[model samples]
Target: MTLDPSVVTAFTPTGKLRASINLGNPVLAKRDPVSGEPCGVSVDLARAFAERLSVDLELVAFDTAGKSVEAVSDERADIGFFAVDPLRAQAISFTAPYVLIEGFYLVRDDSPITRNQDVDQPHNRVAVGKGSAYDLFLTREIKTAQIVRAPTSPAVVQTFIEQNLEVAAGVKQQLESDASRFSGLRLLDERFMVIQQAMGTPKSRGLAAATALQRFVEAMKTSGFVSAALERHGIAGASVAPAA
Candidate 1:
């Protein structure tokens, strides 16, 4: 796709496209075991978008989604991959989602909470990664449950254990991995939410730039690029979003 020069400039005012990548979300990105560099589905998309803009790609890496979102919101980075949330959309214009992932709740196997709706008891304290999609979503949706925040998503389970919280909320894949590392923990039979993961640029970038990004995302989804990336990266519990 040939974008207008203005649109390209909007995405790459620094001559290189800076894409904020969050390594905190294992399903989206992670440190390569051998090379110790960032690699995963988000990295692939960032590189591809930079190429579409015909600019050098500068990956600005963060260990948390909040930090990554802040980078793009502050215009420190030109673009980023993020979960579509109403709060984040205030400063970032997101495309239709390119991937869909589920949010789940985890608890000790002996715990009485066996269903997603059982988590909102007045006495149950839930652990969540501060400023994550889960945190933001649950903050609004969960009325009775108290939320305790961990420093980052990867630390949510540890925080839950350390604080003796009743529940840990996070990505299904992440919580499952934590369950394996520990004992006597199980996920609820159903997911609490479906996360729409999409590309975003600062709303300051203008409508034309946002439209270009939206088009890019839809094209990638329809072309099977997203599905291919998930398979290549061995990412389960996430799937390509339908074209918008």
Candidate 2:
């Protein structure tokens, strides 16, 4: 497939494709324990996009999704991987999602919050990763529960424990992992929301960049590249999103 030079330039203004890698979102990206290098479906997708553009790939690592979004909004990153969120759309032009993951509530095993629907209560204090899709969604959806923001997604569980929060909201996989690591924690069976993981470019990059990104994502999905990437990375709890 021939890429338009203008689109390529817009995605790589500095002549290298700088992708903001958010390690906090385990479904998208993770740190390799042995090498400390970033890996996972998002990393694979970024590498594929850089290869398609025939540009050198530069991974701008950020520990949190909020920082990753800021990096792209500030134009420090040519492109970024993020959960498609309306609140973040003000600064980013997100393509159709390439992967879909679930959001859930984590609570103490003996806590009264027995279901996802029970999370929003008058006295409930919900802990969430600052600026994440969960935080943004819950901010708009929860009318009663007070939200306490943690510094990052991976820190949400610990923050909940440390603060004695009634409920913790985050990626389902991360919460599940936390449940296994920490005793007395359990994830609600029902999902609170579905996270649409997508690639984003700065809004200032214009329509061409957005169109190119959307096409790239759809092609990756239809061509089985996304499925292959997930399999290759051994990532679970996420599926290739339907073509948009």
Candidate 3:
């Protein structure tokens, strides 16, 4: 079967890459908001995988990271990039995390919420991508603040910039890229989750596929290919675990 040279996105701005890439406009394109390109660490990792796969990276952008999983589950792309969790494990397998991400509270940089406790104030609102690890984390941590669920990381950034919300929750890398746009927006250093970045395959084929995917990830980690890929993408601080 011929490989389909196509890309699909779940967000609006459509993340762009430098190489000969197939672009899929999704609802969530995390940007500098000022630079207007793919700015998150996730984008970097995804592009690196595309390069390694030797196929034109087909990014199926989603308004939120949660929606991106659908693309992988549907077989639209060979895999997807996201923070892995047990709930997602039931749907897809993940690669070893490349970066150590901690939970952060995003708010206007000038706001008094420079710390975690500040966000617990009544009437404080925080935004999160629906079904994202951050979203899952926030639902557990920030029960006091009203939660605004955005479709994509970019949209959540936009909402904060547009003054539609009070705070946001996500990884530091993503929040940092987005905060660069709204200088007024800043990330609170208090982190919550210990997430590892991994690729996912649909849980449909049962143990064989799951086993295969896990092995592929393990091989990538052990062979140092995964580290090389992360470095190529400008994502540092990731090391692969030995295959068990």
Candidate number of the best lDDT: 1
The CA lDDT of each predicted structure is 0.94, 0.90, 0.58
TM, every model: 0.99, 0.97, 0.67
* Best model number under TM-score: 1
lDDT of 1 by residue, 52-76 (tens): 9988999999999999999999999
Sequence-dependent TM-score of model 2: 0.97
59-128 per-residue lDDT for model 3 (tens digits): 4555555667666665555566666777667667665654455666777756777777788767898877
lDDT per residue for candidate 2 within 1-244, as digits (tens), equals: 6788988998888999999999889877888899988998888889999999999999999989999999999999989999988889999999999999999898898998898778788899999999898898999999988999999999898999999999989988888887787898888889989999999999999998898889999999999999998888777878888988
Measured with C-alpha atoms, the lDDT of residue 55 in candidate 3 is 45
The whole-model C-alpha lDDT of candidate 1 against the native structure comes to 0.94
The better-scoring model by TM-score among 1 and 2 is 1
Q: Between candidates 2 and 3, which one is better according to TM-score?
A: 2
lDDT: the better of candidates 1 and 3: 1
